[model samples]
Target: MGRGLGALIPDFDEDKAQVSELQYLAIEKIVPNPSQPRVIFDEEKMKELADSIKCNGINQPILVRKIDNAKYEIVAGERRWRACLMLKMEIIPAIVRELTDEESLQIALIENIQREDIGPIEEARAYQQLIKRFSYTQDELAQKIGKSRPAITNAIRLLDLPDEIIEHVISGTISAGHARTLLSLSVNEDRINALHKIINDKLSVRQAEDLVRRSMEIGKVPTPAKQAYVFEKESYIKENIWKKFTFKGNQKTGKFVFSYSSPEEKQELLNSLGIQ
Candidate 1:
């Protein structure tokens, strides 16, 4: 399909439903619905379910909408759809359900989220969809999902990430911890750069966080090297000749002076170095 979700799955099936209730079942047929929004199925879990289906022979059917003679849209159980596909079964058991676009999306969101398995990017997309398509407020979404406003806010923030970083995070090139650390960076470009560095350098989450903190601290300095250069020059005299001379300087090197004490110190220096 050369599209976003298509990269995850070459194709998807929507022909059947995993037998719910009468309200759930509307029809029974197999159609490959490629437009389904939910992608990124967990492979390990799919294998487990595939084993179960092999033993019990698909105990439950899935709910889907008829797209046409040979295609159908999934209303729920995308995971089941993926598992069945992996099982390589010719047909899946399903009941058809006719739902409005909004209803189907809501169901999809609830289904994926309830599993606690949706990726941050997909979850953020679903949240944005709810907001843009259905005019859902953050508070409303929070209330609907039994979460706090800050939780909702943070979840939505995932959408602000650059597409490349998001793809990296989704593809497991970087961890979620690293992704969150990158998100903490205020600038989008810097965040993206850090993301690339994290992957390239294989930096840990803590390392990424420390790098961000250092970057912020460096950002705060005023004429940083200007102040540092003066300090270094003045400290060099004291560091190299502390036993022989004392030195001091003001904000610039022009004020530096090397000092010696009375004859007693001068004689002590000569004695120490055997320079008598």
Candidate 2:
């Protein structure tokens, strides 16, 4: 998925330019990244920021890159830009730097992460986008972002989940932990069942994982082919020797037996099976 799409977008990394001077630009002229990872912003939080800017004003300028003579693409501080727009500001302070689309994406992802602006799902999607658009291997991307590889892998796994379950994570119906636990269930129905139980009973992440493990164990009963072979071996000892029987194991190794009443009964039973 990544390599195919990555070709359409130009990509590279150069020495990052430092902020030297602030450039105030028209809000109308500046645009948001079409691939912005964050989809949800807290309404109350936006209001608070807008109110703050209304009175105290923006202390830190936004970041942008010139796309054309009159247009700029936001590289970071989208929330600030949006708030300024909320207040209907004509022009706002920004730091302009030349950046490739790849650099712009990486910086945007990092900035949102540092600010805790995006949720776990959004973070995952952003990581996925970075990898997809720029053809980054998971490990390569992890190194680029200074994250452990497992963190990147786990975040990407969330996207494997069903959309319903994904929405649950988005809506705060479940934590990212619970969603990952749900990923453990290979079957869609099992995942849905586990999700239902998680929400209905309010199960913790550990409990939800336990539920999946237990379900897997129940499903791991010996295959009928193996069971039939074991039962056939038991037939060799004595056909219909006893009404009650027990068997445990698989093809290479296992146990088969029935209880005897007493010492005499045990000996008689063994003798009946042609034991010395």
Q: Candidate 2 on 1-276: residue-level lDDT in tens? A: 111112222233233544347777888899888756554556568778989999998888887888999899988777788787667788999888887776777677655554545677888887887788778899877766567999989998999998768767875878999999878778887787777777767789998888878878885311222112223444333335642244555577987756542344456567766888
Q: Over 4 Å off in model 2, which ranges?
A: 1-20, 220-276
Q: What is the lDDT of residue 4 in candidate 1?
A: 17
Which window of 10 residues has the lowest lDDT sum in candidate 2?
Answer: 221-230
Cα-based lDDT for every prediction: 0.58, 0.70
Deviation in angstroms for 33 in model 2?
2.0
Can you list the residue pairs that collide in candidate 2? none
Q: Which window of 10 residues has the lowest lDDT sum in candidate 1?
A: 1-10
lDDT of 2: 0.70
Look at candidate 2 and tell me the lDDT of residue 15.
34
